[model samples]
Target: MQVTQNIKAPEMLIDYYKAIEDSSARMLEAAKHHDWDEVVRCEGACAVLIEQLRYRSQDQELPPEQRKEKTRIMQRILRNDAQIRILAEPWLAQFDHPFEGKPQVLH
Candidate 1:
């Protein structure tokens, strides 16, 4: 008798990636509308998701097939991040311009 099978990959890892992607999408929407507060909120959420993903990755490895999927997801995430930064640079410069000559307060 011969058996052919592949071990199943853990679903939790995929879930974490999905959650991060969702957060990035939300951030993109917020950035489009110039809603920095919402973007920051989503950014915080993404940070937490990243920490969770890091912890999960220490113990779980994706299957070979899923590796491709993970790569695609990561690419989308990077694209979202790049666009967000592009949208934010001018707004950030506006903030910086006002404080350039102000006295610094040390706390």
Candidate 2:
């Protein structure tokens, strides 16, 4: 008898991507409510997850069977990022406007 693995690829990648999607969704909700702080916090969390995913991916490649699922997840992430950027544009413009007339300060 031969032992076989059930996972097509390292499931950790899927889990990490899912976690990022969940955080992106949360950020979208917070942005909808104009909760900029919470959105920032969630964005921070997403960044950390992204770093971990990158590190993990450096050592593991997704199997052919799992590539399709990864592509779908990536699409969803892109859509979420787009929506979040749309929601944040006005808030970002507001911040920019306040500094438009100020002299640039060199640190």
Q: Show model 1 residue runs off by greater than 4 Å.
A: 1-11, 100-107
Single out the weakest 10-residue window by summed lDDT for candidate 2: 1-10
TM-score of candidate 1 on Cα atoms, chains taken together: 0.80
Residue pairs in candidate 2 whose N, alpha carbon or C atoms collide under 3 angstroms:
none
Q: Residue-wise lDDT of candidate 1 within 24-100, one digit each (tens)?
A: 88888888889888888888888888897898899988778878888899999999999999999998898777868
lDDT of model 1 at position 6: 20
lDDT, each prediction: 0.81, 0.77
Question: Alpha carbon lDDT of residue 2, candidate 1?
Answer: 15
lDDT of 2 at 70: 80
